[model samples]
Target: MIETTPGIIISFVLYLIFMLLIGWIFYRRTQNLSDYILGGRGLNTWVTSMSAQASDMSGWLLLGLPGYAYIAGLESIWIAVGLAVGTYFNWRFIAQRLRKYTQIAGNSLTLPDYFENRFRANSKILRIVSALFILIFFLIYTASGFVAGAKLFNTVFGLSYIGALSIGVLVIIAYTFLGGFMAVSWTDFFQGMLMFIAILVVPLIAIGTMGGIDSTAASINAKNSELLNALTQIDGTTISAISIISL
Candidate 1:
């Protein structure tokens, strides 16, 4: 849990206000379904890529991944490598082609819409089924984001879990309602920048404070040399290929 302070509270309040303000600004600009749903398809390279990455990794990268690393030691490297390779292929092969295809497919705005037009489904069954699938999966997926937000708020502010969750839900809905895609993309860009800094800078600072990279490695090795092993678990067991694939 975090120690509460006036500065911390003030900082959070200010951040929320800033995010809300951006949403409001974009709300005024959103004139139609296209603008609201796709940000007029006008996002620059930086905003689009950063927002995609921000939304993709979310809190899992910060909270869950690190916890796994602390337990599994260097076995976490496989996860990182997989993510990097997957993201590269996704952007290079799929996203670019899909963007153009969406425009060609009767200016489809959503994934289901794209599939419906792309396939010329006269029955509309494809669209309905695809939407249902998306809803089912996204409900589960979005729950993770909500839970992460609740945990962060609960830990940082000493709020009850319900209270934290309520606040997080309200804020998320308000922003999405206010600015739609444009607001989300812009806010996500900044959030991703902050997450990037937190992920890298925090570890670097901790290592430096512990002495340096060499000293930190030495300290960990003193506790368990296997912590430095990339191909094995912290228990000195070789990590199985099946475990890697499952992860």
Candidate 2:
């Protein structure tokens, strides 16, 4: 049987309730399409950047990264490092251009609008293609989140896998539909903070429980000496657990 932590469970429940409350509070602000879809583009830089990264990463950062590290090894750090590098590049190169273009193109909100205005395309086919790309990728992205949520529910609460998937998708859709981008952004910022803190603290707690990094390493080695060994042996290189787990 698994050991339980009442404090952790209670705190998590409170956090969920807080998210639900925030969603409700934003419900009234979404009076029209623009408000729902773009938060009327009123978010300041800090909120915009935080929400952008939050929406981009979602649950992947919180659960997948560390799990990868534990399963694979040091190689998993590359995924996290790459993500940080990519985010930095996006902010440095893309963010300002996007913000400026979004405004200059007669306040175009959706990306397709920006493209249509930028190219002055004759057929609007470009816009259609852009929309299709967004729809396809966002669905893929959101579906991945559903998968993660299912895993989380199954791991933490022993919830039925199908039920967890349904609940996860429904909750995401409900909140997104009700409040739109602003809602998504605000929640993303909040969720990002929670994820950041949780990821940071969980390791410290684990290390404390395990008596430190050296002890933890020794214990893991005791269980599986091969895991502690180098990646290659006799031209049979092992796949790093970190990358595999994160992916």
Candidate 3:
């Protein structure tokens, strides 16, 4: 049976309460559409960077990436490399230009709005198509996050699936319904810091507990030496470097 201690329950409850408090606090300050949409465009460099990174990573960084790495071994490193390169170019080249263009294009609030304004398009078709695609993809993305959260809660607390799912949805809705963009951004910043710490600390602890890198590598190789190979055949066909990057 999975153990769910009282201390863990208490700590989780307190964390939820704190998050709700943050939502309430920001809700009071959210007075207009601008505040609701983009935090009135007043975010500092640190908050903007961390929040963007946090929102981008979300549960995928915690769950999906690790699962992929576990299954694919060193080949999974290509995903990290591709993401790092893409992110760097996005921030370095596109972000500032897009921000400035959006502001200049009648102070557009959303992607569809920006697209309409940027191209000086008068047709409603572009906006309709864009909105439809966004809605479809965002629903898929949001559902994945909810599923990840439910799995996490169920594993940690041994809660029923539906019960854990409800809690996950409630926490998300609470903050989003209460405070909108500012609350999301602030919470994202905090979550990002927590994620960074976890990424560093957990691996260090695991490495130490396993006696070190050499021992860990030896054990992995003992099980299957193919896992140690960066490029290897799967089911008779060689896995291409390009395919790994694409994955």
For candidate 3, lDDT tens digit of each residue in 135-180?
Answer: 9999998888889888898899988889999997998799988998
Number of the top lDDT candidate: 1
Indicate the TM-score of model 1.
0.96
> What TM-score goes with each of the models?
0.96, 0.83, 0.95
Clashing residue pairs in candidate 3 are none
Candidate 2 regions off by >4 Å?
1-14, 221-247
Model 2 C-alpha lDDT per residue in residues 106-130, reported as the tens digit of each score = 6787899989988888788999999
Distance from true location, Cα of 134 in model 1, Å: 1.2
Better of 1 and 2 by TM-score: 1
TM-score of 2: 0.83
The models' CA-based lDDT, in order, is: 0.92, 0.76, 0.86
Error of 3 at 39 (Å): 0.4
What's the distance in Å from true for residue 155, model 2?
1.8
Candidate 1 — worst ten consecutive residues by lDDT sum? 238-247
Worst 10 residues of 2 by lDDT: 227-236
